[model samples]
Target: MSTASPHLQGSQSVATGPKSHPRLEIRNIHRYFDGRAVVDDVSLQIQAGQVTCLLGPSGCGKSTTLRMIAGVEMQDSGEIYVDGKLICDTMFRVPPERREIGLMFQDFALFPHLSVADNVAFGLKGSKDEKRLRVEELLQKVSLTRFIDDYPHQLSGGEQQRVALARALAPRPRIMLMDEPFSGLDNRLRDGIRDETLTLLKEEDTAVLLVTHEPEEAMRMADEIALMRGGKIVQQGAPYNVYTRPSDKASVAFFSDINVLKSQVNGALADTPFGQFLAPGIADRTDVDIVFRPQHVRIDFDRAGKGPLPTATDGVPARAVVKRARYLGHESLVEFQMDYDGSVLKVTVPRVFLPEVGRVMWLTVPRNRCFVFPA
Candidate 1:
């Protein structure tokens, strides 16, 4: 509950990424169904050879938006471009088969009767030997060349997924759209296949727009993530920036443990329950919310006679009771109740800082380490 004295410095830098430009663009896309906007003015671009994940809760328009791009579902009004060529507009709508876009649905969509080679060749239009060559090459790329003659039922879930991907890539489409590509497999297989799939996509030089509801999956796989909420994109950025420096309260607390402290901005200092935090006028407003990660809070044992200020720090004091203590091998999470506002807060500390249960400790948080946004 005690606020750490402010000491750390903060840095601001421009958002930067690879120099590649986007290859697929969805401009002012709007899709409506059953008298509601399933996709509301959603627009995003995916660069070639990079994975762009559309992440959100269920019913957040991610799948619908992807389906719209694939021509599986028609948008009420919008434009879809593939490699800078207009494919969908109000006047003309391209059929899914003619869009030159590969689709990997949630079901994997492998035909039960077709062998791996036959399934991959289903997308190709060529002589028998040419289709066979393409299928065999893709099979090797996905590490499934040995399963060429095997039926879909004979393969493991991961193998089937690899086959599905190979089939999608057979025609060498301009873009690939994947809907929860690894959802059905067990955790272990899912992790392995996720890595393998990404490697295959990179090797194939395929631009992909993947849709998933899992944050961990998005963080691990995506070069950039576009987070959706209520049929709109709430935020989109690289994984680290989206997770650490979120723009709003909804985004900050969506998938992380955040301590939202009420603070008043005054020139360089913001007063919170913990202490007077040093905050530059980043928000450029008098009233704003300061968000701090529990992991950034530094806690140390308070000895009876060590520091000059016995129980107070920088004219601010924290009275807290150690409510809970948990050790998880690499680190420990400590929880306490702040006396100032009766708020429960937690701090993740390295294993070396493990304090005993019911122990009283003082904590300090450098203001610059926290982020501020409008409440």
Candidate 2:
């Protein structure tokens, strides 16, 4: 996916950010049903002209948050702000028509009975000539000008998605909210539609908030990601930052795979089965868990004289026999069993450096790279 549009400045651009207000804020939003809290005290902010992705598993309240922002569902207690204006509040429920927001759904919610042009013009509130012009402009913007007269049933999935997007944009709403816009298409079509949708949204300078569960999808499309769990936002930040420096174990596991090492706290030195490792500080507690990515663990099969030693500042002595090695095009994923650890660690290395299956190797952990947190 392409980077954020050049028009999207940093987060501090409230006074000078894109066409909308400094930001779109969802503050302390709560929603419940059947006496169960589906969305509990969640909040997020979307910058103008940047995609803020709401990512979580199913039933995590992501769709409910989108619906509340679109005025389709009422919030139990929070407020929705657009360009700094209060559009949603518990006391004053604004009708969907008056929200001045654009909504694109996963099903391509189009009118089968209406032609493409008429379907887009359905949301427009203007004279016949003005509505016709708006529809024509949007159709051209979405590259569906040739299919303008085709009925929804005759159009392809991508074409239908484009039509839905065109209809959402016909009113020129200040903000746009999309719920899984590419959920129904095949992989090839989904990728194309995603790129096309993003391009059009950028050209129009529309502020967007996309809800999705696919990690790669969110990483590719979002300028920032808000990871939700248990009815609230557990963490939110730039994709790289959130992926590399997660605040908690749950947040870390949510984005990527990791290996946790058990360490014994002894002042500044943490002793482990692999080797004696030192860190910045340690709690008085005797037990701690350290997490690190597979790429960070350097593998050594050849050592000078004393065999491979755990000489790394915080390295561990992991005696593992290579169990399996799968060669990918550019890299190979090597899985091995570490002595009696009861867990296998998979190391990803360049395909050019392949090791025999029965050979043993030393596993080293860098002191500063390991992430330590409460178990």
Candidate 3:
């Protein structure tokens, strides 16, 4: 949120501190397979002590971009730089093992035959005492010092993950690449481990690029999120900015359930059941979509078959018949059929508020909460 120098180009957005080199930077990275581009012109910058999530659905090139940055998979084009020094490009390359980059995947990948301390010390260099000291320090940081002599088979899934993290950090890598590293843990353990891992990574001041398809995970872990789709980043910014001010309808839908109202633009305005929405630059007769999340729809009791009067902020209320209602843990979701067009719309209310099917209610949407996009 506190960006020093912000730059925007097409769909890509990057913010960097002034007069400081980013710990990891990739420019126009492309990767192809079977004559199809798996990664296309992907670019991002991660500063030290920052976590940037490359977030998207499956097969959206998030993993490929991470692999390219880790130096395990070469990009077809583009350049990789660390501290303003070029590490990889079309003509030069840095081997994965020599790149000083740490990698953690869904699988712990620790050797069952080796002790925990030995596994962590595998990447360290120095005398026996120094290596042991480094391993002990990392184990303590991960809160596994007591299990230093235990093998991977002796540890639980979460313990094994902590060991893997310790092993990756023992070498003091400047950059850490994580590919759905918490996917293996159960929901109960996943949250705790994620927080712990984040704290450890930040303490080490490592630039982390995490690849995740889960929007919740990205929002929870990322200092900045680069939303990827079809091998390209469509939006990149702080989690709040990316969510509150999306680039398009698809971007909005990616974060949560969305309800769309379709209308034709006339005189820079689109008429909906609630009221007219301002479509500033849209041409007359052009089709447009008014998109808003379910939570933004306000519900009120209907009196004598009439709804609330129109207001400047919230437009006129419209009558809707309840089609169904389900109580989700944190909120109640109610689906409704509009009296105006019979179109279905969903609204979410906090806590348990379940109305019987066929019950009538009035709904109003705040004009400012809606997004008008060309259809």
Candidate 3 residue-wise lDDT, 287-330, digit = tens: 88888999999999889888788897888899999999999999
Give the TM-score of each candidate. Answer: 0.86, 0.86, 0.95
Off by over 4 Å in 3: 1-15
Model 1's lDDT to the true fold?
0.79
Scored by Cα lDDT, where does model 2 land? 0.77
Evaluation by TM-score, superior candidate among 1 and 3: 3
Model 2: per-residue lDDT, tens digit, 1-375?
A: 111112212232122355655457889999989988889998887766778899998889999999998888999998888778888898877688887789988898898899999999996887999999999998998898999889999988888999999999899877889998888888888877888888888777788899998888898888888898878887788887667656666676676677777765677556665665544445555466667676667777745422365454645556677888877888888877777575688778865656888777777766655666645
lDDT, candidate 1, 254-293, per-residue tens:
7668887786667667777556666554444466677777
Model 1 / residue 26 / CA error / Å? 0.7
Please identify which of the two predictions, 2 or 3, would achieve the higher lDDT against the true structure.
3
Model 1 Cα displacement at 334 (Å)? Answer: 2.0
Q: After superposition, how far is residue 333 of candidate 1 from its true place, in Å?
A: 2.5
RMSD over all Cα atoms, model 3:
4.2
Candidates sorted on TM-score, descending: 3, 1, 2
Model 2 pairs whose backbones collide = 14-22, 274-316, 274-317
Q: What's the lDDT of the predicted structure labeled candidate 3? A: 0.90
